[model samples]
Target: MRSSNLLKRAHSHNKQTLSSLLHSRGTSPHPQPDTISGHKLIEEETNPNYKPEHWYPARIGEVLNHRYELLVKLGYGMTATVWLAKNIHADGQSGNRKYVTIKINVNTLGEDFQKGRRAIAEKLFSANPQHPGYAHVRFMLDTFRATTKYGDHLCIVYDVLREPIDLCMKKFPGSRFSCGKLRVLLPALLKGLDYMHSECHVVHTDLKPDNIMMGLGDPNLLDHFVQHEHDHPSPRKAPDSHGRIIYTSCSDFGESPTEAVIASAKITDIGLAAWGDEKNTKPIQSNVFMAPEVILQAGWSYPADIWNLGVMLWDLVENIGLFDSISTEPDHYRPEQHLGLMIALLGPPPKEFLARCAKAKWYFDADGQFKYPKYVAEDCKFEHSIHRMNAEEKDLFIDMAKKMLTWVPEERWTAKQLLEHPFLTKERECYWDTPSLSRASTASVGSLIPSRQGTPGLGPTSVPNGSIHHSSLPVRLLELVPSLASSDATEPRLQRQSTNGSLKASENDEKSTSSSTLPLKPKMETLAESKGESNDETLHKKRSVSVNKSNESSQAMIDAILNRGKNHAPKAPAK
Candidate 1:
């Protein structure tokens, strides 16, 4: 009878509207003894690390703090168990009651450690709400202590979110995100980083796929999950010798609508984050994604996060780690082996860079050469590793990665500068038609003069002019004139000449390309005429050329723009 009733409930659940499913006004049904079974195995129960004394035995329908009622276990990690819970005390219609995620940490962590972690999150998330990147970071809503027979557990509350990015990647073929998906996800993540670094002054030392989470793109996912769980209670194991029952976690949120796309992402887990002013020698970041400075104990800061993100991004796109040589064995990772892999891909670290590193002597000799030269894999080059991209796309992606993966911390591009990278902004250029360009030229030219103040997190506002940086203008100009790009088809697209060097665009052969002799007026008139612009509008638009430069002159300007970074390369800061 119970089995038949559960089947009927599930069938009825499938036909209910999302609103009716989630906002149903009634007390949730209690888990019945007939529904509990000891046959199904729970993964956490089988783990050797499972300790009954350390974990809080939270049961379904149990209310914590007299407010939140536990609905179902979402996941469990080494240190915590997460659950979906309802705010019974929230003032709303029964069907419209608020729901939240409760992360209950292991009692072994102690109250102080959990409180400290909560403090850091509260300080950073509330630092600057007006910043654009604020929305991309997961904010902590509340925290409290729950006392039980086992020990005191610290419970942290947050708004409900979808699963982590690592799990999301498994849904895609080859376990990789397409460049199109990256275009959407990466910017959202970068915005979060910009907020953490620029506005909050917090550095997220750990930034692997697990730390980044996908947002709830579909509103019905949570509703469906709740209804499904209510209909069919999760199977549970019988009591152990210590009388602890382990329940199977229900993590599936159901298949998304075919048209739904993951349009938002948020950076979570700031427990490892450090303030910019608190630069220390303590090691940070995951093993494979560790920045050179961090591995060497060379006093890292914001740039470490950039390097971390760059490697993680590569892992997302290529479905493998860039530094794959690092051992995964617990407590057996060798820094020298990781450094060798870095050398194989990024060439040798600059002697000046190695000089400041406290641990560099262990890896490099007095001459600044790798002590274990044979460990360097000669075949592991950056360009050869990238697959499935055309020459232009590959070049742009490499350019963006190189800016972040530099050995010198000062050389790495800041989060704001990377936002304007050609790889990221390529889609925006498609909207620039003839009339759009004619109107936007003045404003775009004005953007060339980097703003020193006004908006935050837009560009370099504090750095001096001679600092090592990539200019977005040259790429913007090339994007504006597609004819000029086509005119010099033979010219090499933007490519990295060396691992340690600045990126350079091609200087077309002087005599062969029409760009050398092309006049601005004829091109503008042709563009206007092609767009069916009246002669009078074309004349009026011609006067809008704020900078009195011909196409030939603009070509010269682009060359200057490409070479400017080399001339302004910044010196390493004093240790």
Candidate 2:
């Protein structure tokens, strides 16, 4: 009944109630035990009260704006909690207060949940540098951890959205909005979506009505998001009949929002959002909103969200889902039936795709189902007749949806491209004006630590550790030897010549000292006026190729002296 809070109460799950079926006692249909059982349905993420040791607690709510005090324990789940209370004070002013929503520790929902949510939030913020419209998305107020009575708690504060989209659609029919409103809303959705794709590198896998909510307005077209970091942009106030700032927000990330919500889209319900490198939040099930590729058990890509967009658009543009899974026969889930939906709309799966699928034995029939003339499943032709609108509107919406719903993932239109399409072009400039898809966005990175390098789709795989990488050899050697002009080992050659010159100079000095008895002028002049035989320039220029030991190291020079066995090179007895 209360749509906004009902769907937003994702972390607070109610245990199942016992109906009349449980009334079995002695005279009743079935016997009952003393222990009572109520529906506390749980899967991987059950509402956990378990506190592993060393996992301590800390208070999240601290110095606030003088009035509001966060009374703990509104609700909690596997990952986080929702706190409810009335704000009584203000930080800068001795002021009055109101109630709001505070969601905490959103990351522990799982690695994927944390990664995807932060990925998009960062993406949106980065995409539109100065837009206040995106400010409403629940993001970190500030982060700090401390010990308390419970355990570890990660926290965030948020504006509590009082109403959700399903209730909006229920309360106000198609008459509530018009072509004008859709023009603005569609591009907004695209801007948000484009930020997620190019900037965040994430996909909102689940989309439905309940996730969105009307923002701070009397409920008209002027809606936008708010978060701690986003300074609610100076309002461009367009008044509804009651004259209020039309503000709206997609409430949760539990699932991806459908594209049709360009008119009434709300992003909420993030419990099933993609986690880790994959959408490992929950097990796959038979859901109508899933793309055909998911149905075929093929891996999901970022484009999988586009198929969801097409389906959502189909629901809004026409009053029906393009592929209604609820009505699907059990057998329609198989490849041929899966293929049937595409044929009915996009026409047969491209022949190239069939050829590819043919090689994938697990997806096809083993006994030649494709070759049989009697094969109804394989050969059945699909009727793609459109009776809804005149040829133009039908062709336009259908063609656009097809681009968003392509079979091959690479061919699918990204949110940025979709926002730029004719369906949304009326407001394309408005969407691109703020332009939320930026290259510098950090969506492409998961963690700054060097260790997070390769783990599936987070980015590309890393090269092995042992790669020789010989290209760096010269560069590295140059770091050690600043003057090496070629592959010839210049330092070794120079040292070798220095040793030989020194030894020869010593001999000449001894011979000339005979001048102490003879003349020392000849040797002293020779030393000053003439370059020795090993001119440094001549040695460097020579295209010499040899591993001369004496040239290679001082150790070789020591060996030469040892061969002479020291004894001072047999100095000519004091002349």
Candidate 3:
């Protein structure tokens, strides 16, 4: 007992010492006034490595231009660390203090590549000012370059998002998305893709569940939190190197903080986005999600993205990959197996598709039969495949998938064309017919919300007041093939020129690749948590932690989040 008490006292003393060191660095726990504008003070000049700092502007507690304060690390990937930051310019606008996602580009691209990235990203932004406001696309608010010790860092600011679609699937009772929710989400994805392809002239080569994000938090409260920042003045807080909090944003909500809702879905991570006209020589897209023509070294374009979206849709609703993503034989190439699975499920490719494929001989004979016919029929089918959806729904889904997954790239429907397909538009009014449907769907998952404890053990449930029937999520091909699941699926897309620099591989064939790899579930943090209110170990260790500080609205948000999960729980599998 005496030793335990001594240990507690020692921990307390050490924490206090750390606090004192932090306080000594500034007058108040907040950022020093001069640095608030994101400017380097004269004292910083004494550090001979000031220029080097510019190479890496993403340090914890680092203030930029004295305006944006890096608070919590929302996430990090190969090339960037996404920080949740507060704009501290004291612009006297309430919105200045609201949360923003700042993506700081690592010095991973060569000078030429970096220039190309910057130009393309800017073109995308300038092409359509209203594109960010689209329901499906992640909105970019600002962009700038900062010099650091490592090199010049390219930074882009965007609105904060909740979690990706994969988590939404896992959070549900049986790890599946409800049909109605899928109905709402898939179309939103199509609309965003259409807008990007037609309007922005961009092709998001990497389209997968990891890239689709669901919005959380009350839009009204978040809006109010930012818009009224001058009036409310959220106290500023910063986390230490160990992710310990030394300050806090003192923003206050009167009595009722509005509850958070699942907003409309959006497409994110346009890092590998290329213009439709540009013919990229390098191989692109993740392997499992790659289009057939891409593997054959045949030219690819927008239709490839459509194929990716179709596969992504299957993964989203069914909780399983449409393709095997694994190899069956040592000598037989994996891409051939990928095509074989397609044939086993959708039938043989057309002569036109076979003609276009330069390497068709590798997988198919002159007569269009798979070189190894047995691999096609027997190996692809799994025990937990999608066998439960009613015949009508299954037919509709297959119809759409077949249309998009055409062997001939040109035969696939354009984004705009897919939007018009009966599958996407039949059940509900189209995005063009009723603009308000987009807004309505954001807050529409009311009764469908689940409790906070965890997903319910119950089986499939209806999508609250909707016609579509939810089903038990099928196990993915990768899950069935343990070896394939463990393989680095995205690596082939890029041939690492240097461990630090980014390079696209012409030979590797992942359908989508990015500078960053996503976590199974992204950690969602609130404004309070961002301000160093919690410690690092606690935040990182907890898979899903809600903001539990004495804020009722935060508590309400947690309840709603959990409740949302319970509402989507699936039924038990049949005997």
On TM-score, the leading prediction is: 1
Summarize candidate 3's per-residue lDDT along 24-48 as a digit string, tens digits: 4444434342122123222112223
- Alpha-carbon error at 349 in model 2, in Å? 2.4
C-alpha lDDT score of every prediction, in listed order? 0.62, 0.36, 0.49
Runs in model 3 with CA error above 4 Å?
1-57, 90-97, 128-135, 220-263, 324-333, 379-384, 428-575
Instruction: Show where candidate 1 strays beyond 4 Å.
Output: 1-49, 91-97, 256-261, 428-575
User: Number of clashing residue pairs in every model?
Assistant: 1, 44, 54
lDDT of 3 at 206: 81
Off by over 4 Å in 2: 1-99, 104-155, 174-181, 218-286, 317-319, 325-339, 351-360, 365-392, 426-575
- Point to the candidate with the largest lDDT: 1
Clashing pairs in 1: 23-95
What does candidate 1's lDDT look like per residue over 1-575, in tens digits?
00000001111112232334334334447644223445543544444466877778788898998989998777766667788898988754444237788888778885566666766798776888987779888888888888878789888888887667766676676777766677667767888887887787677888877777766656556666776677656655677656666765655454431213354688887767786645467877767878998888788777788898988877888855788667855477888888988899888998977988999999999999899988799998777778856554565567678766878765565676566565665543342333322222221221222211211222221222211112333555554433223233345444422211324343332221110010112335566779899855764443332211222233343454445444455888999
Q: Which 10-residue window in model 3 sums to the lowest lDDT?
A: 1-10
lDDT tens digits, residues 1-575, model 2?
00112233332222211121123223423422223122333211232443333222212244334434453223343444454333554332311124455554532345555565565555544655443224323333333443344444444455554345443443334523333444445555555544454344545565544445544332221121221102221111233223211111222212222323333333544444453234332323235556655654445655566677666664543444555534444334444444555554454444433433324344345442333222233332211433444433343345456556655543454554454333433222221111111221211110100111111232221212311122233443223222221232222211211111221110001111000000101123233336554433332222121111112232232233234333334667785
TM-scores, all candidates, are 0.70, 0.45, 0.56
